[model samples]
Target chain A: MANVLIYANQQGGNLSSNAREALAFGSSLARSANGETAAVLIGPGAGTAAKEAIAFGAEKAYTIDSPLLAQYQVELYLDAISEAFEKSQSTILVLPFDRKGKDLIGRLATRSSASALTEVIDFKVEEGTVHYVRPIYGDKAYGEYTINRKKAVIGIRPKSHEPASRDENRTGDIIPLKIDLSEEVIVSTLAEKIESALSGVRLEDARIIVSGGRGLGGPEGFDELEALANVLGGAVGASRAACDAGWVPTSFQVGQTGAVVAPDLYIAVGISGASQHLSGITNAKTVVAINHDSEAPIFKRANLGVVADYMSVIPALTKALKKRMGVNTG
Target chain B: MHIVVCLKQVLDPELPPRYFKIDPETNRPDDGVADMVMDSYAENALETAIQLRDKIGGATVTALCLGDEDSEDVLRRALSFTADRAVRVWEDEWENLDGQAVGHILARTIQSFGGADLVLTGYQASDIEEGLVGPVLAEELGIPCVTLASELAVEGSILKATCEAENGYQVIDVPSPAVFTIVSSEKNVPRLPKVKDIRLSRSKPIEELEADDLEIDAERCQPAVALRKVYVPDREVACEFLVGEDGPELASGLAGKLMELKVL
Candidate 1:
């Protein structure tokens, strides 16, 4: 039976949504493989996150409760994760494919001599072997592979799987893990963290998104899109072009090199779809395009298309949406 | 000081849908249907190396790629960006290598060249998007690694990087002989190659080696990933046009339709 271990992400004492999602995915994988699932949560909140892991689905949790883990330092976290992996003695490892994971996946795999598959979207079991599927070619294509190695580390893409249901009544074990977080181990030191000015619902978790593009003349265009987004209770996104033009933060960019989102409703304003941009929203359920050019490539993939300038269109659309939804209008 | 930059040649990511054909037998993109170019992020890494080399006097940038003969084009492109040397590593029938295999080959190659003070790679390949090679290579060479970095600074015998994280960004400092995977940005875009540099790039010689020369066992040198299938997903949806007389009417039409469908 495969023993699956998850490197659960947690800070001070709060477990991240990504960790919850991973616990759910990893637990299900273990059960399907006729194995057990466990998680290693590192930080001041390790104890709390361990219990949550059990409620979410893991059978046992390993904890490395150190204030040093309150912030994610790659070298320290990697050392803690590798230690947890060794203690768990699991053949399979899973972690959220997030900002920190992109750094740890390869290093962890090499340290343990395990083969890795990153940003996996799906997996299947056949005769006790796991076959993995992931997006490749900028989401234009998908690749499925069977690992030839004995040990495998998989990085699950964000929002690819449902977060696990909680059952606080379920019983599980919590085991504390020991690791030295001293100054000598600082091969890579996180010197400082600069906060971004972005404030709103995160793009990945939003159900509806109102995205602007370069077609909107300048920064003024985003202000218009924000009005529509507010009326619809949605987050704001931007094409790479808009982000490149310094009209929006790079965090707002939804494209191949930016955030890959799968919101339920994605509204494109003044955006002529590029292949890379389209790839990011491939999983978005319903797409609405409003562009002045009827021949814009976005029309092909959009569920609803409107030919109009966003300058005039956004105000009317926001007004209409606010009216229909009974939103507050000053 | 020596800096090594890793580059990759991939199918054009911007190819129109009409040219996106998959080979029925191999489940891979149909050969010769789409033009190939240097992976754009690698260009960012190359640019970062060249810029840093300029900032630090007497430093050389080496461009390295692992692919078929066509991959040489990326090396030449790197040369156009002022890379001092280039190395191409490949072998007959060595396709679809897993990240570990590629890491092993590259780590050995860097060791053969006596290593470098800094090794830079594109944060992730545009095609696979796994981004394993840099860290794996660093681990293989027993050095530290930093990924998803947007900028780099060289202090007095120290290297610092600015990398993105959730809700913000972080600056990390490490010693030399480190690996860094760089992300692309419009602010630090790759510069256009000059005609004089293009001529000089053609005059430079590329060091080529076979996968066998790395001394990896034959069993370990086989195709890295055993792919069960590779298929393009159909993500298109039918479009309902909202025709109107003016911009306001069109906007209203779209809003009304969305409300009717309960999309808002």
Candidate 2:
């Protein structure tokens, strides 16, 4: 049987949301292959994460507990996970398409002499063969690929698949694997971590995002967006133009070359929606554009187009939202 | 110290969506856009390498790319932008190679260079967005790799890199003889080639390496993933312009629409 193994990625001792999606995809693939689904959780509190993976439809879970694997050091994690993968003897490996997973899948595939497909948005199994679908040419086109190798590693994009509902009564075996990590191989060491200015919700996780562009005039313009985001309980993002103009950090830039986010609501202020920028937000459920230029390209892609100056419109919109949501404007 | 930056040339990603067209028979994008440029993130990686060479005296920056003859343009562009040497690995058969095959070829190419103290690549190529080369190359070379690094500095045999993490930016320090995948940042905005330098870059010879010369096994270089089909997705949403004469009116209209959508 072609066992499918999903890497249940964890952060700060908690299971990541992406891990659930990967597990769900793995479960479906395993069922099609007439095999079993397993999860490999490598980090602290792997035991707890394994239990959670079982609730998400995994038949078995492997936990590699180690102190050195606490932080996301590539070498250490790869060593630990590769060991778990061998233990499971799975033919198909599913991973998340985030920064860490993107970095790991390729290396793991190479080490195991397997084939790999990255950033897969969907998949299908026909006659026991799997086809992975992904976006190409900056999301201008979608392409489906089928791996020819005996083993295949696939990285699934976040939010592409619906996560399977958790079943508290579901039970599975948690297998613990021991790893001996050496300090000599730890060439890369984390020196410091600087938290981003806006903390509560990450742009990817935020339901609503208030994004600004060059028309915001300067860095000061982001303050209004932050206020709107706060009122809406969301996050603030910036166009590449704004980030390149030094109005905001590159981390806040949302475009093809920057962070690709899909929120429920994306409000673009003073932004001319360039195709590159639109690719990142195409997955957003509802896009609202507020631009002074009536013919800005962004209006074609937005769900709601408001032709006006954002300086006058953003504050007004924030106030209206506060009043409608019954949030006090103190 | 010798630093090698792997570069890939791709169609300009900023091309308007309406202009993009895919050929059904070939299952590939039509080469309609005239301007083919270096991948933005690769430019960032090249910029990072150039900056490291500037910061540490006597460092050599070599740019490597694996593509068709048209890919030479980007190599020359890299030379004009301050890369000291350029190498292109191309063969007609390479057209069908997957990311894994490409990674093996790159690792072999780096090994043929005697060895490099550092290697850099873009976080992901804009075309296929596979992002498999850097880490896989590092694995083949048996070196550590740091991905999505925005800032990098070299001091003696130690390399320091700052990368964006889930919560924030994480600063990591690694020993030399490693690989880093650079992400675009303000500090790494590529410098435009000067007119004089652009003219001089023509004379800068780009060393070409064939797949045969690299002693690659033809069978091993076969693509691991086969492309089944390519097509454009249908537009799902039709934009609706809000009917309002003023700012407050527009704000209220948007708020009302949000309520109607049950998202408020």
Candidate 3:
């Protein structure tokens, strides 16, 4: 039986959206396998978050609430998660492939001796075994894999699955797991969690993005991109090259190793599309490229391509956009 | 401080997309199309290790890998640029091992080395991109793991790493004998090997190891995850080029099309 346990993490007294997505996903997968979906919500707001998990379709919610479990110290979190896994007797575990998931999953799977699957975008269940599909070669190809072991731990790629819709009337069991944390030893206290710490529209939340690249040559071009982004009410993003050259903060980088964004409109300015950058925009609804190189690989993925110098093109585009949108500039 | 950096030779990720192909029988990237190169992330890990070693004063960086003879080239590359020693662990019959199995072999190999102060690896390999090795290795060794570090520091046996988060980064501190999976940053971009160093690396002996040498569980090394199939995902978008008399005209035309499509 595919009893799936999802770590429905909460932030600011509510179940985070990604965790909801995971719970929704686990519920669907469990139903397919004729099993149940349970969520382990840890720390301060976990009791409240448990209801949210049920709203998102979890059949059972395992709450591990402790003031000591407040912050996400990996060792403490891992211990609690392990306790929930055992008590719930789940065969499969699912977590969102976010920053904390990357930190905790390997250890969790290792402790349980479960097969670890990373960044899976698709999955299939046949004869009670799960098969996973993940992007490889920077999303140039897809590879499908199945776990031979009965126990499996999966890290679901963020934004790959839609957020689970909520139903307030949906009810389920809430099991509060009693766990001992008095003996857990951790050498490190993670240097505090600073929420987002970004000004204006956060890149992850941004619907429209104006991203620059090495082709900008220097930091000044980002100023123009910033101006355009400002008028369009979007976030500014950079490629690894631009960020590497010290033109922008590494946080602004949009690539495989950087922030993965799924914006509604992505404008690539002066960027020669590399797969690392291409992978980040896989979910973008519309891609527009403005580059001098006509043969830049980005053109293949761009919905609209313009071969030109971004310096002249960006200013014109901004002005044209203002005129087209009927926005008055005094 | 003694740091061991795990390296893997993979299909050159920078190869043109059109040249990419998978051999149906083997379900592996066609070796004919792409030459194997040191994984980009491994190079960053090596660079990060070397930098940390330099900071720690009189430290050694050992290069480790689990691959065939062709894998030695990457070890040599590591030797050329700051790695003090090189080791290769492989079995003749071992082919297409999953990340968990590879992690087992690596953990056993490290155990044979009597352990070290730190272990470093790339966040993930470019080919399979599993990213399970570093954390799994840490688990097998019963040590802590801090992953995706953009910057690392060694201060009196405690290792401090600045790791990437969603919108910001975190500074995590772990004690000695821990695992670190490095992510590339401007601060850790790999440095090139000098010609003299490259020539000297060719003469340096690469210590070869087998499953028996480390007493690894050969049967247990079997893949936890098995590859079912390999296929290319079609993501082609027909692009419409905007031509104009000048830059302004092109911009205006592009803007008009976007509006028509209701993209903005």
User: Model 3 residue B121 lDDT?
Assistant: 93
- What shift in Å separates residue A278 of candidate 2 from its native position after superposition? 3.5
lDDT tens digits, residue span A81-181, model 1: 98889889998899988888888998898788777888887888877777788888877788888877777788988767777788989878999987877
Put down candidate 3 lDDT per residue, B102-134, tens digits, no spaces.
888899999999998999999988888878899
Computed on alpha carbons, the lDDT of every model, listed in order, comes to 0.84, 0.86, 0.86
Minimal lDDT window, size 10, model 1 chain A? A321-330
**TM-score winner among the candidates?**
3
Error of 1 at A212 (Å): 2.1
TM-score of the second chain in each model?
A: 0.93, 0.96, 0.97
Task: Give per-residue lDDT, candidate 1, residue A261.
Answer: 85
* Per-residue lDDT of candidate 2, residues B103-208 (tens digit): 8898889989997999999988888988888888898889988988999987667888998887668898999899999988879989988999898889999999
Q: Which ten residues in a row have the lowest lDDT in candidate 2 chain A?
A: A321-330
Scored by lDDT, the top model is 3
Query: Could you tell me which residue pairs clash in candidate 3?
Result: none
Choose the strongest candidate by DockQ. 2
Distance from true position, residue B54, model 3, in Å? 2.2
